[model samples]
Target: MSAHQPTQHVASYYAASANPGPERPSVSGRVECDVCVVGAGFTGISAALHLAEQGQSVVVLEAARVGFGASGRNGGQLVNSYSRDMDVIEAKYGEETARALGSMAFEGNRIIRDRIAQYGIACDLKEGNVFAACNAKQLEGLREHQALWQRYGHDQLELLEGEAVKREVGSSRYTGALIDHSGGHIHPLNLVLGQAAAFESLGGVIYEQSPVTQLTHGEPVVLTTPGGEVRAQRVVLAGNAYMQGVEPRLESKSMPCGTQIITTEPLDEATARALLPNDMAVEDCNYLLDYYRLTADNRLLYGGGTSYGGQDLASIEAVIRPKLLKTFPQLADIKVDYAWSGNFLLTLNRLPQFGRLNDNVYFAQGYSGHGVTCSHLAGKLIAETMRGESERFDAFAGLPHLPFPGGRLLRVPFSALGAWYYSTRDKLGI
Candidate 1:
């Protein structure tokens, strides 16, 4: 791909099966808006849609297509809470701060469902998800996890053990599991695309292939693109991992890490139902986790493994195939229809970093790995801040953001080493 090549969606299952969407024009001439959002991923679209619904002149600029990043490429699991759960937040921050964050933890899931209903989106929305435990220790951890989530006002949980787990997931690998009835999955690309359409319906303008090349921060922030410039009263940097060169301040505190996914050829209806009996998403309890769920078309979508520093792996299939077989060896003959990778922003503390670059320039990134829900929540919080309801936004903005221990150059190796240590412990059940 050329340095200035026009952006396109990655050749993933989501792209091949995505709903038809218009190819919007890039930024041109001098554009003005109440809010100029950088990046057209989930955060940007969510913010733009919310702002537009409230009758604000919102302009969203995308270097590539909408949902082209991890927003479209993720496991599609609507997992709740932050990458670091509420217990970690309370331990590190305080009970008050944890309470504030926990109150909004499950709100993202609600927002998604509401949008789908209100706008009549067709994203194959399914319900329920399982947290599978691989060992006795991990099983106990699920017990603790359920209790923790219950303490935080999210009580739609059920523990599965013995044959009960097998009824939900045909695999015998899980010693036990926790099912979140409210948690679920969807056709992520369609969800974002539907939201984008809704935003446009509300008079929100989206500029595709328009990467913000230069950002001159001030009261009326100016964002310059190759074709034109946009002046807005406030700006939101929602690029996440793809925002590397656009802003240096965000790059220091976060690192971009790649995750891979594979979708199998459409399986027989019986086989698909057998894999995920109730059609709920499943994620293993491991430092290097494996998440999978059956797509709407009866294909198994499995994903896991991480490549730090956004380096592309030689073969995504090679890394994920064994894990898929380990869970269901009977599917050894199943052909993978698609394989692709996407990058997500990671923070040192495994929490999201939400703050301001200056007075009117705000950004929310570093979802670590639990971005599907948090990114939407981030957008809502950002809009709330702009509407003078900064209490919820301050809960995140007040959290301190520390740079990677070894800086950007060495953050990859350092994080890999830490992952190795934790993964080793997970293996030993320590």
Candidate 2:
């Protein structure tokens, strides 16, 4: 498959309703800083904010506007864990390392909450989330997960039974669930924009519409954009799935997976409460999961369906509407006000990849579906590592990540084949 060009963010509910914020200027002249970060998503902006707070000169370069990528356009679920389960981490690494990583994942959620309060971000924040089980097999898995959380002394998770699940979520399709008070949702674009504003407040510069075209790694790395260049003591590659031609080596490790979402017209208070009694974000346990939550205005923001190939307005709406109706068929009569899609990097191991390409060049990506929280935490760790504290960063960097088997040319086909098998299994109830 050919490399895809960078696409603009679609006119989604988030974009239409985003808070009025100051616009940032594009990079036009040569500049130097202690660190130059690529991509103004959560990871980049968060890193910039942390580094700037340390009194380091920081510059953030974004090919598009802030929150133009997945950071601004996700399901808005701020889950308190990694993309991979703890058991998977333990199986891959040792129990000790897995426990340490798990603790850091929980810390990620705390970081987002603290930032929101500290910065006075106006994103509507809620305090409950549920992982609904679709089948008997999945219900068993939820039970096991609850037990594991208890073993880890994570008492925030409570196992909700059939009736309890229905009480929390108004869906009969889900047999049970794991309710997490630590998990929550927010206006994603607002959160990203707030980070950008905070970063600027801390004396960091953000350059929008400035894509790095080339890089020269050395004692002081050199970054070349169309109209400018930045020479910094350190470089951060936070472009994630939208890296473009920045780093070919990191690009080959993951593929861009497109996910779609749709938002309904605002429902009356009664209808909204009936749809979701507790106002908790609900996500089903499927390889291709269905996640939905109510907006502050009572609109049901439902997300599901993945496009391995590409995404357009019509294609995204077609795949997501039916999934929305399946959970709450009463919404069939309501019109879908907005539909959109975002690209997220998916790794073979379903884990975030965090490490340094070289001692001076650091990179972080591949949060899979759990990026909002992980990306924030990854940014803090990157900041810590820059200050010569690498204990937490080393835990993540120690995780093994294998590059795509077929390289750039054949990786998509290989991934598609594997995804098809999993989708088929999900369909067959196996």
Candidate 3:
């Protein structure tokens, strides 16, 4: 790849099996809109779609092809809450804020499903996801979590203990599990592309390969790009980890960490069902969790491990294969068909950072790891703020997020050190 070569989706199962989509034109000349969204990933496009549907002119600026970032290449689990659970948020903030945030905890998944239904998107959307527990302590934690969520009027949870977990997951690796029937997975890239197309149908425009290099503050924010400039009354920095140096203050609030995944060659129907009989996406409760699910073609997509500062390992398969075998050793002879890594923004407090830099400029990032749903919810909150309804957005903004211990240059190593401690505990099952 050339130094200045435009970015493309990483070679992964999603990219290899991506659905057909029109090659949207790159940004050229001047563009104006009511809201200019930077980053064409889930957050940006989600914001654009919601704004456009409400009769607002929107423009989406993407540095690469759509869904070319973590949004497209994630573990594909549709977890229904933020990275930090509702009870944690309630403890840190208060009941009022938690109530507001919890109420929309599951809306993001609904929006994705609704769009798939409305636009006839063929993303192999599936229902059901499981939160597996690795040890007795984590299992107990899940039991408490299930009860807490019920107090908030969310009772779509079923607890599976020991042998019960084996019925849902073929492996006996887990002590227990919490099955969320409402949660599910999807072809994330296709879900994003479908949303972009739906945005276009609502008169929205998306400019691929157009990355904002500078933001000039004024009446209408002027976002400069190599090929084009976007001028709009309000602007959204939805790039998350990928939005580096665009704004100095915003960059200070989060660290970019890489997570990896690998997909096995297609498995026979009996084998696939035997692994995940219920077809539910599964993620464990380890400090560094292992998440896996059966694909539409019956291949196992397993992912885990974290790299700070977005430094990728020489071979993702080398790092993840051992973990896969430890969980499902029966597949010792199985071939790894695909492996890739993507970065997610992590805040020190483990909660998403949502706020505005100044009037007319909004941003949301640092989902920690629960972005598939929270990012979509962030878009709706941003739209509501632009529409002068700031209550919901303020609820999230009020949640405090601290900058990394050392600034951006040193935060990566500092976070890695902290992660090492937690990972050690996971190893000792402490």
Candidate 4:
């Protein structure tokens, strides 16, 4: 283990408002379970909850604390879609499979809502999200997206014109928007914490401060931590960007990218309403998007931009605050309260990677920037696969993922250059 442990959670607005809860026990001595999960983020906790509910013995091990990774630090927009656009899916897999994938993506949001309701998780769930377009070109793209979703039987999305979009989002930056009624936002950290608590209440065991350094796959997989080990019938790797040398093959398929976020001090309810009357989450249609929402206590939680290779929280705040001001210059005098950054994994194809290393070792990751709702759906599919029903799991497992072009050491640099090119094109309106 490193001399200094990573901070257990980012200092985001979500963490500050999270429910007070008991810390999970650390793994001590050798233990065994039916399934041993590595990483206590949403995917792991959600899977453990479902597996345990089915009376399976499940143990979840976390390097830091639950929700300490992107699960806690994301933009919190639960948009109902995969990272890949519908057109790309259609181009790659043809219309039928693409439509099926789209429907599954749609169900992802419902899975999240159902879990929240069934587990009684209080995460400030809100309705509606707008994907706003900044330019005429992007407006046309948004219209195409709305049509594609409608073709796939998801007609909940409404196309808002330029003036209507400005009215809806209070931002003249957007020329038009696509409003998805099912898309929404949540206090993500609290959602993860609540899921962890619910998982524990259902007799699932969670071990914190435990990083799996080695895995020996067989009839029962052996997972070794610094202080302890777990031998289980099945292993699920939900670590995503934080897997960190545990699996070399899986590591090459995804790279960690850092994203930054900041929150303003609480505004009066009237001021908050002025900013967003419907409390709908809003994200621009830039390749490098900016997403923001209003908190239950009326603070503006804004997340935008990414730092390719490394992250400096202070610098991130400096860059992001101006972007926030650009969206709502009315809050110029308000104080900025929280700023933080976390790493999320992205696949080369911008699609999730789910497959079995062997028969017993299953991994699900690479949700790109769309993990919030997708992670819940992934958990459900993982649980179902473990129970010998593999249809949904196979759907994602069938997607092809290539290793990063530059190998592990140079992948970050390569990805940084590629992202810069895309961001440049976005700026150039190409």
The best candidate in terms of TM-score: 1
Compared with the true structure, the alpha-carbon lDDT of candidate 4 equals 0.87
Best by lDDT: 1
Screening candidate 4 with a backbone cut-off below 3 angstroms (N, C-alpha, C), the clashing residue pairs are none
lDDT of 1 at 215: 93
Give per-residue CA lDDT, model 2, range 251-324, as digits (tens): 77787888888899999999999998989998888888899999989999999866663344467677888888
Q: For each candidate in the order shown, give its overall lDDT on alpha carbons.
A: 0.92, 0.86, 0.89, 0.87
lDDT of 1 by residue, 1-430 (tens): 1265438999999999999989999988999999999988889999999989778999999988999899999999999998899999999999999999999999999999998999999999999999999999999999999999999888999999877899899998989999999999999999999999999999999999888888998879999998999999999999999976888888888899999999999999889888888999999999999999999899999999999998889999999999999999999999999999999999988999998888799999999999989999999999998999999999999999889888867899999999999899988988
Which parts of model 1 have CA positions greater than 4 angstroms off? Answer: 1-6
Write down the lDDT that model 1 would get: 0.92
Clashing pairs in 3: none
Candidate 1 global TM-score: 0.98
Off by over 4 Å in 4: 1-3
How far does residue 118 in candidate 2 sit from its true spot (Å)? 0.9
How many backbone clashes are present in model 4?
0
Q: Model 3: residues >4 Å from true position, as ranges?
A: 1-6
Q: Residues 349-401, candidate 3, lDDT per residue (tens digit)?
A: 88888999899899988899999988998998999898899998998898877
